[model samples]
Target: MTTNAELAARFEEFADLLEADDVEYKPRAYRRAAENILAHPSPIADQLEAGNEEAVENIDGVGDAISSKIVEYVETGEIEELEELREDLPVDMAALTRVEGVGPKTVGSLYRELEIQDLDDLEAAAEAGEIQAVKGFGPKTEQNILENVEFARTIGQRQLLGEARPLADDVLEYLESVDAITETEVAGSIRRWRETIGDVDALAAADSGADAIEAFLEWESIDDEIESGPEKASVRVGDVRVDLRVVVPEEFGSALQYFTGSKDHNVRLRNYAIERDMKLNEYGAFDVSDVDDPDAGQRVGERVAGETEAEMYEALGLPWIPPELREDRGEIDAAAAGELPDLITQGDIRGDLHTHTEWSDGNNTIEEMVEAAAERGYDYYAIADHAEGPGVVGGMGLSDTEILEQVEAIREVDAAADIEVLAGIEANIDADGEIGLGDEVIDALDVIVASPHSALDQDSAAAADRLVRAIENPAVDVIGHPSGRLLNEREGLAIDASALGAAAAEHDTALEVNSNLRRLDLWGSAVQAALEEGAIIAINTDAHQPATLEYVRWGVHTARRGWAEPADVINAWDLEELRNFLH
Candidate 1:
């Protein structure tokens, strides 16, 4: 199968080539194709094998040449043209282009003239006084490259959503404090609530665009300034790239709607506008048919202005699309059919079904966790600390005997506090599908969450069987982090989710959308499949610490991606219904 990453990398390489050649339209076309391909829901190889070239061409901005490139790359391991281009250029193209202000043309020039192949080689040449001797290379250019190389290596990968959210909030607050900035919105994947974020993008409507850009560049929190132009400024803040674009108030909503995109969603929306003899872009929408000239028409190119996101959607004859559901899944269809789901809100969740306390590995005690839940207006919560045996070690989890004692202890805290705290245990599902805690202890707890903590290397078929059996256990109320994947660091167990979801539904068990940003497993597809099989989803934060309870937002957003409505989630029920299901 052709991984999306591979296709994206190729598109970027193509973009690099087009830029080096100084071809305007080709570069934008490739970049747009890359964006659409990355946002596609299914694997490109599956579409190709099914003989659906339309799937490739259906993407917005993919032209014939770009589609052919994708087909050739999938059939072979490499793109022939990219390979030829690489051979023509002596530089380590990827590495050279990473330097700030150095694009592919600069790389090509440096490689042909100075013979720089890698970051280290470039640095050595710059130090040896060879790069400055070249015609187009100046002392400033060489100096910048030498300084940025080490920073690039130490900058680390992009920030995960868990790390970026607070930073984005802080940025928005800072921007709002500035008098010149009138409106602000965080755009890009962070806005889309993607699991991982490469950058934090903010678009602002300002009274004075130039002043706003200058103010953003001078912000104290910015760790490093990457680029600052008249309308935009890019900075690096604690391993996350933050880009801010300043626009006029008149163009604010239109720009926000365009920039806050799952590119695929915007493409579809744009195509919808085109079908209706209208046009949409970052500036605004325009009525094409109203213009006299189809080719040389100015009104067709003119902005169909909007001052709010609702106006943008309204012009398109639909309701506003939430940023979280901007990914091109079925959102368009839902919007067209007027069947958009009433997404589960934070307030809709009446209880926190899975949490930890000092009884296991959690930082807070039972009373503290319950009080925090109460502070958040939750009517009920479950203290699901770890249970002993199998994956449990270092006395981090309670023994079977200790679990019964803790249940009584939980009741005491629940009675004292104003909130109801159900006794629960996060029991381990061993290799053989058996939970670590005995049935007697499990039966005593108000909620039993069975999770896989070991043997993650099992074959896919075996992994699927293990999960199915665990969910089938009458005492198991929830399956925790179905795939157990850790973003960027690890790929967890793979299971046939459809089979597992069916089993869970048959057994009256609920599947959890583990809200730990690091592990958003039961991903969107799994959630959708689970819902299709009539399985209820529990959006649990699986909070080990007080601050982590906020992660439920990401989980709920993830559920929206899976097409889960308020009714599809078990935790969205009242306290009594949730308790009944646990029993």
Candidate 2:
């Protein structure tokens, strides 16, 4: 039983292997096919298994060859060509690529030059100063490899939310068809929307727990059954492990509340309940204010609440806290005081202020990208492609003349386009905290997103000052990917969020929580800090293609974790108000 995710992973591995082998054009093709397969509404392998090869091939990026491979893998459990590729390279592709500056080509080069097959081999060579001696390699490259080896070594302990979440959605969709289950919801850190998750946790309410577990175990996507009981089971799905728990319909609310915890929040909540002579547990809330004997059992008191999550919270005289805010970060007190901010939702974002096009390094044309935004029902869209500066390598950033030209093209599109269009530029902030854009270019653009592409290794103090300087510039409207961090990939930079947020507020500059899965910069705590300082947040995807516009979901969740409200997000405003704020 092949799952969409498992099939997608196979192609991703194929893409990497081909890239490592320096096969031209085919790598990108395979990667695109993989992305499409992963995003497909149903399982391609299932279609293939059912003798629907045409249906599998009809997928956007899947072609004859790729579909044939899908058919081969589905029928026989292996793609012979891929196994051969593995034998040829014989390197740990995933682990090696985890190192900061290393990619498939570099892995190929290292493997060919120094026989480095894995992180251990790479580490040993770097430590022994063997990498520096290889042709086309230098001491700096060797040192960088050494520095990132340990981080690379710890590659697969957690799964990316972007990857794990879709699989969770698939699981939920499958369980919805179970007749025995009355209610179903995800639990644990996944429900809280952590950037990285240890495993996927799902909860179900059912009259018969045995029936629910039986249905779960029969899931076609499950690769291995780790364990199972009458009401609970754990299974492996691709690289992620999923744990499912089923409880009686009556106890579902309490069980969900207890499981969807940050431990600290639950402890704090339990203490608060104890102070009121109430006992809280997964069973239900109990009023134990009066008991003649102290030796009574756990359920010895009157059950006051637990039928639903809201009721559970009401029993303790508190509002229902959003899962993202259940980190025990003053949310309990905020709920009690009736002062919890209404967090921003995905629908609140009206436009994308920071995005890319073919004018720079983006994959799509301006017209294609604009059409995608219009389809998403956005009121406005800004084409803020790159402006030439440091760290924007291989002539990826546009020149001043080209930017002005793109501005006119954008205006032309705006004339007949369904949405308001703004000509913008993502200008680079150099090490000295200066924007390299000329006055003419700045005046011509409708918006400016100044970002630090270089000097991402700056310490906290330097990073804070550098960003603050950029924020204070009157021409700058936003600071993009403030910390420059790439989750599970690169450390990027260290900045003082308090200092950054304060300066951004004073100067009316918005700080970006880049929606790209890898870099959710200005993450939860940092976004919270910035919000506390009265700074605006822009959850931009920084999308290079139309499909990536969906990254806004990740940004929205990250913002909610930080307690961001619609009022605190500039793009969440109407066009008129957004213009006022930009101005």
Candidate 3:
């Protein structure tokens, strides 16, 4: 069966192969079609199979050529042209492109010059100084490819939360129609909101576990059924593995708590429970104080609580802990002392402070982005387009004169906008931590977000001091994506989070938990350490388009992982409070 994910992946591959073969406009069309297909709510295969050709044609970017390719793939299970392109290049496009700077053209060049087919081949060529000899290639590109090879090799071992969570939600929705199912939820790392997930795990509560498992296998999104048993099943959805476990309605809570663990967290909690003469496991929480051996069996004593997750914790006189805080990082102690923070929620964000407009590589115009934010009921919004400097790519960043002109443009729009619109600039923090903004430009802005775009390979101490210098710059209001890391793409920078956080707190500057899925900088542990010094955090989407303003959801959960409360996040504040902080 063709799942949306599988079809999108094929087109993505088609685009890469076409690009490698140097096909021009067609590649972008295929890629855009693939993205739309992945995001399209209905299945193209089902539409094609049902003879609804118009539905497929109506999809954005799916013109005559792309639509026919979809039909051919659906009807015959293959596209003849894609196979030919694959044969011509015959390289692992996905794996090869995972290296930071290696694109289709680079892949085409390397394959033509050095016949590099995979990471192994690329690494061999780079190590032997072969890549630098190729035209338009040099030592820097070769070394970067070599350095990124291992990370690229291990890229698909885990799925991004942004990708997997939606699939899990689909699973829950599918299982809801099962008559026997009493409850359902995502489990494991996905539930904990880890940045990457190994498998999409889900749980269902039902009187008949076998019936629930049967229903799960029939899910329309499933690409293939891997295994199914009486109480559990595993299946492949797109490229990721999804596992479903069905338990008795009575034991649902206990199962959820046991499965939604970080191993260390469960171990610590189990030990804590043992001290209270209680035994905990998937079966249920048990009062084994009078039992001869709590270790004798999985369920050795009278079950005290198992009907609900809260009861499972209540059995031990503790409040139910949020899954994001269950990483064995003092959460257990905090819970016991009633000190667990009221973690920030997605609803708390009032506006986005780090958005872009077409003025700086954004897809939408300034008016469009601000209107979209207004539609989401944001109390305020800010336009912090990139400022021209060393790392600004292709001269995309704005010049000082342009920024000032844009500032005037924003003010004119702000007068008519439903929400308060702040004029801002995302100035590049150079290697020496200096921003390129002129004093007049800074004076005109409502907020200034400083970010590092180059020299990301600085040593830890240098990285820390560089960021500290930015934090101490009175003109700067927020530091964005402090580490500059792109998950699975590159290990961007290694900064001393504690030192940066302290400097930020001292200077009253905010550190950002950039909401872009690839750059959730100031991740949980770092945020927790920084907040210990009373540094404020701002969860900005760094959105480049109107649609991506919703990326703030990823940012909110990321802040929660750091045990952030409503008070810790700046944009979560109302208009006045946010303005006060920005000033």
Tens digit per residue, CA lDDT, model 2, 293-372 = 42377675888887687878999899999999999999999999999989999999999999998798776788888999
Show where candidate 1 strays beyond 4 Å.
1-156, 291-302, 393-395
State how far residue 283 of model 2 sits from its true place (Å): 1.7
- Per-candidate TM-score against the hidden true structure: 0.71, 0.93, 0.92
Give candidates' CA RMSD values in order: 19.0, 2.5, 2.7
Candidate 2: the clashing residue pairs are none
Ranking by TM-score: 2, 3, 1
Cα lDDT tens digits for candidate 1, 444-477 = 8889888887776577988988888898888899
lDDT of 3 by residue, 1-583 (tens): 5766678889999988888888887887787677667656666777878889999888866889888888888878789998998889989888898897888889999999889898899999999999999999999988988888998988747777766776787788888888989999998998998888899999899999888888778777687899889998999976789899999989999999999998889999999999999999998999999999789999898999988888988999999999999999999899999999999998888999999988986757889999989999999999999999887755799999999999999999999999999999999999888988899999999999999988887888788878888998999999999998877666667977788888999999999999877678878888998998889999999887665676787889989999999999999899888878775
